[model samples]
Target chain A: MNTQTIPPLAPDAPVVLEMTNISKSFGAVTALVDVSIRLRQGEVLALVGDNGAGKSTLIKILSGFHQPDTGTIVSQGKEVRFASPRDARAHGIETVYQDLALIGDLSVFHNMFLGREYHKRVLGLNLLDNRKMREQAQLYLDTLGISIPSVNSTVDLLSGGQRQCIAVARSIYSSPKILVLDEPLAALGVRESAHVLGLIQNLRQQRQVSVILIVHNYNQIFEVCDRINFLHSGEIALDASTADTSEEELIRIVKSGLGRKAIDAAAAQVRPGPA
Target chain B: MPPTAIQPTKKNAVGVKVPRTMREQLLILLSRYREASIAVVAIVLVIYFQLGSDGGFLSPSFMSVVLRDTGRLGLIATAEVMLMITGEIDLSLSAIFSIAPYIMALLSVTYGVPLAVGAVIGVLIGILVGAINGIVTVRFKVPSLITTVGTLFFLQGIVVSIYNSQPIVAPVEQPFNAIFGQSLYQPTDALLSWHGVTAFTPFLWALLVVLVLALVLNRTTFGLHTIATGSNIIGAREIGVRTDRMKIYNFMIAGGCAAFAGIINTAQFTSADPQAGSPFLTLQAIAAAVIGGTSLLGGSGTVIGALIGAFVVASLNNGLVMIGAQATVSDIYLGAAIIAAMILSIQVDRLRTRRRV
Candidate 1:
């Protein structure tokens, strides 16, 4: 890997997101412990780990879906604790899960404006302002560069790519400070994945939005991320600038942890065979 | 707009809505007004048949009978429509309806209480029955159809055991009897009676209640929530909507309505029959709501449509009887109509979805 200057986590960097010494446990299972990371303004942080490496647990804690047993999360230098997902959202942190939480039968406008729908005065006060919601959904889709047969169209009729775009657009339209995408490109086709990657790049370049992308593929990380955070054994094994580390070093740390285990030698197959 | 600001986009690449075909438009129109059409057809057919077969079918006495008949079934149908919209079926309502009069009879005859107090006690019995239904479904998570059916039989048995299958009657005073036991139209039983006019009963009250509920269901936020919770419970819950509470309330409403229907029936006859309203529990509701274009799946139904649907069902029965037809024949016709409406609703939903494509 080419050697380049890796920016240090400093107060002068204008950090948008900061997590210090976060630890979480679910009953007897220790999901994450002593994890700390910093995200600068307009930077994408790629979080990669194996299946049981507590990626989901960490995301849940950050997004306020799960409370960390021992940790303090600070947003923009202010100590913050989220009691619920809504609370996290209030602080401009949003997580778009794999399911997308989109209903199939409802119109796009209805789905987008759910829980907080704009209402118009009807004959004084007793009617729905459906026109406003429809127009608002239109404006959002326009901003996201998405096309469909009117905002009245049921989301089920939209393509998989369109649905993901809808989810992304819905989160970002409200101008969330940090957009947490969970496996966004996982089940998408080549075309859909390309569209999503383009969207991510645009979000960073054009909108200057910060992303905390949870992905399994290291190629995706190297392609789009400014920094890579490697998690193993419920802890941050390595957090380095993408330019300062190769894929080889990541493999080395993951394999070394497995080599010490006494179980049926499964780590050799996953990392690589002895050469 | 600034040059850097993103511009609006089109819904389709073609930049046009896929206009609904004429045939498709017709079908959509038919579906929207299917209940109304059914109701109109039923009314015309009833009058035509009454004219052909019975000389007295269009008479004032016959008209009064129709109102009395429609009132009992209309109230029951209202209960069913409300319950069904919440994805629940209350079979116990039939039994509750059957014994509500007994509650009044027991209060008045056995306890020597005033008739007004007896009537109040009877309505309370209705409230209690609804509460039981709500509790069972909420606590056990068992499907309401099964729970309600079990309660139906249990309540029926209790009624029969208490009443010995005999009708109970108590001496009600002039004013109490007048309000509950007479019809609004032709206030006196005999128009040219020598005695003072006795007020009409039951029918107007049922109609008023149905009209008010229709307003409540259509013109209120509660109505919108009802459809939302019924159609997509998970979606509603995700938005912090209290869905379980809505269902529990719906159960209570249906129960209370059924009891009121029973009270109305007892008032009309001034007697208590333990077996009253036994068969009409699900049937009347199914008929009214389905006829009114209310999706049996819940999420989509109108109170006005349900009321109209009730009239259609009532007319079908009344019309058949006026034509000297048997109840069996009417049942067969109603069954066919139910199947047709279900098919129509399914088609309408498909067309709506296809419009997006």
Candidate 2:
């Protein structure tokens, strides 16, 4: 497997958000146990694990879809709590679930402005401001360099890659501080996955954004993200910079349980210090 | 092909490139050409009846009666289409239609209640029944089709037992008849006699109701939310849209329209028949919606399509009678016409899609 050369992050790079010792369970099944990850501004962080490694559970917690049983979420150095997904949105946290991120029946513009619609009063009725919305939707897509046949086209007519791009564009449009993407490249082909990776990279450069991407593609992780956090058996078994690791190393750590010493050594190498 | 190689614009007569407006582009791209094809079929059917019946079908008196029938059927279909667009079905709507007028008659004639107040009571009962349907479906997590079927029989039974399956005559001197049944002017000649029969009042009321509903569905935020909900319930909930409330509101609108239709019937005929709202009405409403291009599976529909659908149905029945077809033959003809319209629309859609591809 090809690996990108290591480039150490600036020692003083700021942490935008931190999840500390987060643990959660469902009745008799423990999904996540004492797993924590930190995200930095202007960086793409990959959250990697096998199926049932509690990656989704951790993401759902951050998105406020599921409350953690035990943890403290510190955003910009202040402890906070989210009551619902809407509440999380108010705090500049957005998530794109694998499915249901966009409604296919609606037009691209409509999906772009879903839940936050612009309206004008006509005869005491609040009617959609279609002109303004259309203009703004075009502007948003243009900024992302996503050219489509028409903004008025229903999403149902778009390709799978285009649909995912629209969902990503909508999440980025809100100018959220942290964007949580769940398995964005799972259902995509190689070219489409590369297209989405390019879009994510563009997003990092264009805004003061932090991304937590749940991906199974190691090539994508090395190509796009700054750091990789390997989750194993409901815990963070390996958290290291993507540049400092190899695909084989990640594979072994994922396929077989990592020893305590190996995990510590890998974690220590990527710790906050000059390498 | 490279993205830059495709140019969608066309030059106009003045040698200036005119950008296609969103409206025009939408018309070009709309996937549901069923409405347009259905409309063409409707026009052709009208001409066919006029020719087949030797001008009897187009006679003002017959056309006027057909229009009145179209109004009632159109209103019911409108309500059904809206509800269907929200991804639910209401079988109890026919029962609501049957019971509403009787409630008005019982209140005003038997209990000495005022006519206006009684009408309000009647409409309120429709809404109450709708609320029941909504709650039973949403709160209990029951499939709407099954829940509504149960309510259909239950409400029918209640109406039958209350009125003892007997028809109630609406008093002619009452104000209810004056507003709902009043003819605009008396007909003096055969050509003008169509208006004289009932003043086209019911059809006018139906047109107004459909226009208002079409506005509500197309021009308002509620309509967008409804489409979103029907398209994907989970997606809608994720965006904080209260889908339950949308469904319930649709149910109330349907029930209210059915009640209004009942009042219109009482006004036109000056009588409330206990057996007025039959299961056949439910089938007719569904048929109109489907024939008009409303998807039975939900997520997409149009009110104008339902209107046209209702007209086609009314015309079919009226034309069949005017052509002197036997009752059984007329039923078969109506069934065959609906099937043919649906097939024609499908074929037209396939052709358009093929050309586009």
User: Quick one: best TM-score, which candidate?
Assistant: 2
DockQ of candidates 1 onward, in order?
0.18, 0.34
What is model 2's C-alpha RMSD?
5.0
Off by over 4 Å in 1: A1-97, A103-107, A117-148, A151-275, B1-17, B30-64, B67-69, B99-101, B108-132, B163-166, B170-220, B351-357
Per-residue lDDT over B1-357 for candidate 2, one digit per residue giving the tens place of the 0 to 100 score: 123343555212111223367644444444456578678878999999999999877776677778877888998999998898889988888889889988888777788887667778888988888888888898999988988899889988988898799878776454455456544343354433543644577777788888988887876788888888788877776666678888999888899998888878876777777778897887788888878887766777878888888989898877877887765665686687667656754554454333321
Per-residue lDDT of candidate 1, residues B1-357 (tens digit): 012243344443332344468876666566556556666766776677677765666555665666666666677777777777777778787788877777887788887888778777777787788878877887888888888888888888899998688888756666766666554335345654422233335556667778777765654455545655776675455443466777877787877777877877776677788877766645766676777777778766665666667666766777787777887787787888888877877777776556533
Residue lDDT tens for model 1, A93-131: 877776665656456776686556565565675644678
- Colliding residue pairs in candidate 2: none
Model 2 iRMS: 7.4
- i-RMS, each model, one decimal: 6.3, 7.4
Q: Model 2's DockQ?
A: 0.34
Which stretches in model 2 have alpha-carbon errors above 4 Å?
Answer: A1-43, A66-84, A186-195, A257-275, B1-32, B172-175, B181-198, B337-357
- Please state every model's RMSD to the true fold in angstroms: 7.0, 5.0
